[model samples]
Target: MTSIPWLTILVFLPLVGALLCLLSWHSAALCRWLALATSWGVFTLTAGLFAAFRQGGAGWLLYEDHAWIAPLGIRYTLGLDGISLLLVLLTGFLMVVAVLVSWRVTRFSAAYFALLLGMEAGILGVFLALDLVLFYLFWELMLIPMLFLIGIWGHAGRAPAAVKFFLFTLAGSLLMLIAIIGLHLVHVEAGGAPSFALEALRGTALPARVEPWLYAAFLLAFALKVPLLPLHTWLPDAHTEAPTAGSVILAGLLLKTGVYGLLRFGLPLFPNAAAASLPWLAVPALVGIFYAAWIAYVQTDAKRLVAYASVAHMGFVVLGLAAWNQTALEGSILQLLSHGITTAALFALVGMIDERAHTRRLDELGGLWGRVPRLGFFFLLFCLAALGLPGLNNFVGEIMILIGAFQTRPWWGAAAFVGVVFAAAYMLRLVQAVLWGPPRRRDFWPDLDVREGVVLVALALAALWIGLYPAPLLQPLQAPVADLLGQVPLGPGPGGVP
Candidate 1:
């Protein structure tokens, strides 16, 4: 309805940037600057959209729909509500961070930036698309660039790790594709016009018996991406093998797509089935917290430890979704936005240390505070946030999630606290081992350079702002969440995250 094709432009701008990067592949410096400028432009555009966005709306603030294939009822549709808008903003912001973090990338540098931009476009497409077919297309779009990133730029075991990530995700995507087709066919058979439009297909009078199966299909796909419990084996490897930028996007954005899928499509399309599956889904989500944390604590490799920490953090997100209350969902979204900042910061720091020390092994790292005090200080800040320290970003989300869980089921709240304890244990141990003891090697490592400082400061500031006052973010969330609850309400409460 709006005049501008803002959503469409937002979706493809990164892609155009990607193409430009490819065209200039011979000029690494040109590619770097181009990627930086393109990413900043996207972030600026997205920020403008956010600022101009109307509050108190329950539907898309901006929407674009044009026929892609009329006979098949597929259309190029994108919807931006509060949820999609926040995530899109995240995609834009993190693309900037990803580029900045990759500033030092020399080998295949142009291709690397292109792939990052390509991945950005794909991720934006996923967040914006409203047509089932269109969404699926975007889903597939993101996969290839990420696959090559790990395979080409990653560490020693990149090949198998990349393969594992691809296969697991592809397996999930196939199921989701089948479910998409099945839903469209059902709508067609029920005397409705053939359409993959989410708005039209939602509440398709799916047979009660068939609903669970379809819902399960969607859940399996999302869960695998959520990497919930037993299905999560591929994630640690992917995280460990990936480059710094890869790890950032994998943790910050890609994993979020899973929960976003469930929030945007699966639950709304099959509300009854989603309600029924809550307890079952909760099992893995709740358990993954402690399980991953325990494993993280035992890891000697610092990078692998943070990799497992991502698993544990994702467990919190899934559990919040399982609670299905406003506070919990808000917390989950907060965790999504804030965790993207804090965790990405952690991975960036780890990468920085590895760059200097030539090792990510805990035993080989020590007394960094004596050498790079600023670096150690920032590392400590994000680590504290990750551990859910009060007055920090992670705490706000966790507390809200816990409150929401408590309202739904007291035991769920109590059990989740155990994971918080484990977080402190692991994070504290990391801080102590890395910053307190004598240097493992006598050679001095460089402190934060201008580029690294800018990125870390950006992340740190966001974390502090969210922790200090999340009201701005929380306020606009109500109307859309209320709309979602109208479709599938989990527990009784006020509309906002509080």
Candidate 2:
């Protein structure tokens, strides 16, 4: 372990704050301030971890372990390599911003902050936990707070969306739980002590007969969370109804957990299954790429439109992962981070619009760019990045994914290329209508306030930083990426393989 107990401190500090806030429930201001302090503290710790991380190693660093349920081989374990470290930081960064954004939600305010802090703790634990059971505990823990966020604090029809979201997630996770137990049994049967540590389980080779089913269960759980294709119907409603902070976290962090699980567990633990399912996986990803972009083009609601674009962007992520090469996996991770930052910004922008104008309908929006040029500009920047414009974060990841896709099959790249064009169409349409078209109400349009500007600027800076110099992000991930790839037997080189 590293000299600093970085992972534990970063993960649990928010939970501590959550408990403290609950203890001091009568003082809303105190609770809000404490929540913000805790979130900022986590972010600062993540910054410290970033500054201290060692790059280009064969395995993760700062690993910690202790027996939790020794009889069943479960342990309390946590660690981070570069990939997870970035996400942990992203979570920490957004939690603070979410607090800032929600500063004025005074109705049930203390409870709200407490739930928010608790949610952040669960999400951070999900990213940092190395034990399977530990990961699932965090995974399920997020559900309660988010349900409250959407149901208690959301808009009209919030209950339905919240219930739908809960049921879908619960069902998927249950299936995944079954798979986890099965994997543990396989490990035990292999003459290895039963263990749920990701590293320990990786050593057990799943039989070919059961690999596909187990892979399907695992992928289904993750894909449903990613809300891929057919499973994605709940997202638009959830986003449309969720509170601004909830929407931001959902788009930014919650969705990524699915893709993260796919990368961290799915491919590496069941490499042969992943390879076998590659053809099927690649098809939906490619189809979703174009379909989501087209749907986004037609959405009248700005938030729903952004929601659809997330589906489209995640298609690129799925394509990269299914491609199963170093470049593609790296690109997928980069895309995940880029999508998190940009999409969260977009949602936050929409939230600001709704807060001011009381609606998110595109037709009801117009000529704000002149009134809110600063806000419009930042929105445009994120929009361009979302569309994968060159010299932006999404572009880098998309290009890398495409390069990796092409290496696997030329047609996959070709399909993704078409999706890119559709993205341009919808995004430009959004930019034109909302920012530059005829004024909906010249008298009422107002520019961003100081707090809104702070949120947008912070997200924009992150997007630009990653867009310009991905090397820092990629370097630490190299070892883990290679470590993951080594588990899969990807046959011979391009020209040499049978």
Candidate 3:
């Protein structure tokens, strides 16, 4: 074992910080700084971990496993591959941003920051947990803080939206729990050690006939979280209602969990079933792409427009996953990263707009560029990134998805291409409405302050870095993605090589 189990430390540090925050309930300033420093500390450590992670390999390094609950064959297992590292970094980075963004939050400030940090910890666990039961615990743990954030600090209708979000996720989680137990039993029948470890379960060769049910259980759980198409009704409301930091994390980390689930478990464990469900799955994926974009074009509320765009962006993720090719899978993963950064920034910017103008109605606002050049610049930059303009991060992800999807099924890719066009339409429309037109009500249109500028600048820099030099970010995941594709059984690679 390495001298330090950095990954475990990264996972639990915030939780420890959260406990400390609770102990200092009366010291709001201390709570805020504590959360920020704790998050920054995690980010700093992960930066070191990324530097240490081996490139182009499939085995766990710095892995720490310990026996716990021996009767049930459970253990505390933690490891990080390329894919997990990026999300962990993203999680840490966004937590720092969340703290910075919430600097002005005065109501229940200590409790709010604690919950937010707690949520960040849970998300970190989701990305890093290597055991199935451990994964589920982190998965459900994510819902509570978010629900409270939305219900308590969220917008007017947040209470109802939070309830809907909770119920939907809980319902799907129940179905997934059964599926997980089923897989556990299957592993037992295969003579494998009783364990919830992902790597352990991957070795179990499931029977062909039962694969679909297992896939369904996993898919439904993730799909609800991703909120694929019909299941996505909860997202717009949640995003629209949650506070800025809540929305940022929702867009940045929570939504990615679904796509992460597909990549991490759905495709790998149930390859044949995943391949079988493509045409049907592709339908919603394609539908969501254009469907969400078109509706976004018509949305009068800026927040809702961004909410719908997330559906559209996630659709590309689904399409890429279904394509099951290297290009598509890589692209899908890239899309996940790109959308996380871009959407988080957009929500933060929108929150600033709403805070200043007391409204987010697109038609009612205009010409803020004159009042706030830096803010306007960020809004335009993020919009271009969101719309997949060349040279931005999303362009790389979306193009890769389209190319990969086209290689598998040209028509599906073609349909997705139209969604790309629709994305541009709405994004450009939003930019023009918010940043180009004459100030509809520019009186005292407050611009980005030092803190606000810090947040948006960080987001933009990430977008630029990922857009321009993605190889560094993408290389770590090559082993994991390749390992995942190798499981597909017929995806142009030898089995077990990924």
Candidate 4:
């Protein structure tokens, strides 16, 4: 709709910056500054786009299309709607934090920073690309950088962890590719051009049996990324081994890709089947909440604890998605944002602690309050938020989810309520071990430096801002979500999405 090609710039600028960082690999400091500047520049553009966005229509806020592989009807298409805007903003913001957190890395630091920038580009591409092929390209782009980050920069078992992660994700993606090809062929069979553009492929009627199978393929692909329940084995290992920046990107942006894929392509393209799949979906999601909580509470390693907690948190988001109403969907989207912030903050803090004290084992960490009260305080704040403390970001999302789930199925709502209680228990257990339980070390650790303080405070402020006043975030989601849910047979909420 706009001639400026803003979405292209937003998606690829970091990629260009990555190249620049590699070229300047002679100095890590130069690369660091470049990554910081590039990430923030993207964030500034994201903020500007938000300010410029108008909400009168249910279509893309801005769209761009260009010829690419024209003979096959494939095109370079990118679009920005409210849903994309939020996720892209999240990617840009966390990327800045990732660079800052990794400021101390000296081993191939320039390469490290380059990979981080490349990660941002890949993630932004996934959120923006309107062509399924382009989307998959970006999706795989995310994998290579992440694999290197975990295997090269991570800890003792990084090798195996990286392998597990790569294998699981690739297997799921291959299945989804088959599904994408299936959809494209279906479109062609229906007298449409051979297009992989989401816009064209959408609504090409599937045979009753084929629809469910294709939908299941997309579901598994996204779920593996969401890493839901039993499929989530790679995350704890990946989180435990990855460097701090890698962990932040993993929790902050990488995990969201699955949920975003569902919202963007899976649900809308196969609405009735998606809605119908909820009953089966709910079982694993509900079970995963308790399973994650139980495993998280018993963990000795702090990072792995947060890793399992991520599974539980995402389970809530999955449940909200299964509910399929506007309230539940909105809550799912908000929780996606909230979980990204709180979990990334926690991992950052945990990484900082490991840097200081040489251990992430819960038994070895206590009395942090007496040594580093500033760090202790921020840790406590984010932990409470993770546990759904009232007036905190996660709570608002959790409450709305319960209400929405209750309206659709009271048992679902009640089950979620119990899950929240479980969340509080394990989350507080972590707080007790790290912040208030007992001193694992009497040696003093330095308090937050200016840079560290800046990162935590920024995360804290975002949590509080959204927790206390979520209207800004909620307002943009209204039409986009309405439009998304409108595709299903239950009812239409607003205009079309693709």
Considering every candidate listed, which one attains the maximal TM-score? 1
lDDT per residue (tens digit) for residues 1-498 in model 1: 389899888888888988999899899999999999999999999888878773637777888889999999999998888888788888888889999999989898889999999889889999999999999989988878899999999999999999999999899999999999999988989888999999999958999988899999999999898779999999999999999999999999999999999989999999999888875676898889999999999999988999889889888888888788788888888889988888899999999999999999999899999999999999999999999998889999899888888877677888888889999999998898898898989886889999999999999988998899988777667888878777886556333222
Residues 223-281, candidate 3: write the lDDT tens digits: 98886898899999999999999999998999889878777877777878876776578
List the pairs of residues colliding in candidate 3: 482-498, 483-498
Candidate ordering by TM-score (highest first): 1, 4, 2, 3
- Residue 171 shift from truth in candidate 1, angstroms: 0.5
Q: What lDDT does each candidate get?
A: 0.89, 0.86, 0.85, 0.89
RMSD of each: 2.1, 2.0, 2.9, 3.3
**TM-score of every prediction relative to native:** 0.97, 0.96, 0.96, 0.97
Candidate 1: the clashing residue pairs are: none
TM match of model 3 to true structure:
0.96
lDDT of 4 by residue, 1-498 (tens): 387889999988998889889999999898889988999999899878877773424788889999899988889999888888888878888988998999898899878888988888889999999999999999998878999999999999999999998899889889889999999988898898899998787768878878899999999999999978889999999999999989899998899999999889998888778878875677888999999999999999999999999999999999888777889889999898999999999999999999999999988999998889999999999999999998889999989888877877678888889999999999999998988866877777899999999999999999998899987787778888888877764543222211
**lDDT winner between candidates 1 and 3:** 1
The sequence of per-residue lDDT tens digits that candidate 2 reaches over residues 325-424 is: 8888899998988999989889988888787778889898888787788888887888899888788889989998988878877778777888899999
Off by over 4 Å in 3: 54-56, 491-498
Considering TM-score, which of the candidate structures 2 and 4 is the better prediction for this target?
A: 4
